[model samples]
Target: MHVTAILSHADEGGFTAFNPETGTATQGETLDEALANLREAVELYLEEFPMATRAAPFVTSFDVAVHA
Candidate 1:
């Protein structure tokens, strides 16, 4: 099954990956590593709690004004 992965830089180092579908998160040294880790985590989570329906999550972004 296909899932969404959100990746960001960690405060300390490396990258942090999160799967919105399964609510799974993990960290890795690189983008590839982060994605791989997220995949494994999502797989394990699914094995325990399978999703009843598979729907692709709608992802989008918006700009927010920052006031000084």
Candidate 2:
């Protein structure tokens, strides 16, 4: 099954990866490592709890006005 992954830089200097599909999260020292970790986490989660639906997440952006 296809899934989405969100990656971000960690404060300590590494990278963090999260898969919203199965709520699996992982981290690594590099982008490639982060992605690999995320993949492994998601796969492990799916091995025990398979996906029942194929609904994709709805991601959007919004702006909020703020005064300095």
Candidate 3:
């Protein structure tokens, strides 16, 4: 099944990966490793609690105004 992954830089080090579809998260030293870890985590979650058919997530970004 196809899923969405959101990655971000960790404060301590490395990267953190998150899968919104399954609400799974993992961390790794690199982007590739983070994705791999996220994949494995999502697989395990699905094995235990399978999900029904759903549409793919629409990812976008918006700007917010910052006041000084």
- Each model's C-alpha lDDT? 0.93, 0.89, 0.93
Clashing pairs in 2: none
Across 1-68, the per-residue lDDT of candidate 1 in tens digits comes to 77899999999999999998888999999999999999999999999999877777789889999999
Clashes of 2: 0
lDDT leader: 3
Q: Rank the candidates by lDDT, best first.
A: 3, 1, 2
List where candidate 2 sits over 4 angstroms from the true fold: 53-63, 66-68
RMSD of each: 1.1, 2.0, 1.1
Poorest 10 consecutive residues by lDDT, candidate 2 = 52-61
What value of lDDT does candidate 1 attain over all alpha carbons?
Answer: 0.93
TM-score of model number 2: 0.80
Q: Residue pairs in steric clash, candidate 1?
A: none
Candidate 1 vs 2: which has more lDDT: 1
lDDT, candidate 2, 1-68, per-residue tens: 77888999999989999987788899999999999999998989999998886777777669999999
Cα lDDT tens digits, model 3, 1-68, are 77899999999999999998888999999999999999999999999999987877789989999999
lDDT pick, better of 2 and 3: 3
Candidate 3: give its CA RMSD in angstroms. 1.1
Q: Tell me the lDDT of candidate 3.
A: 0.93
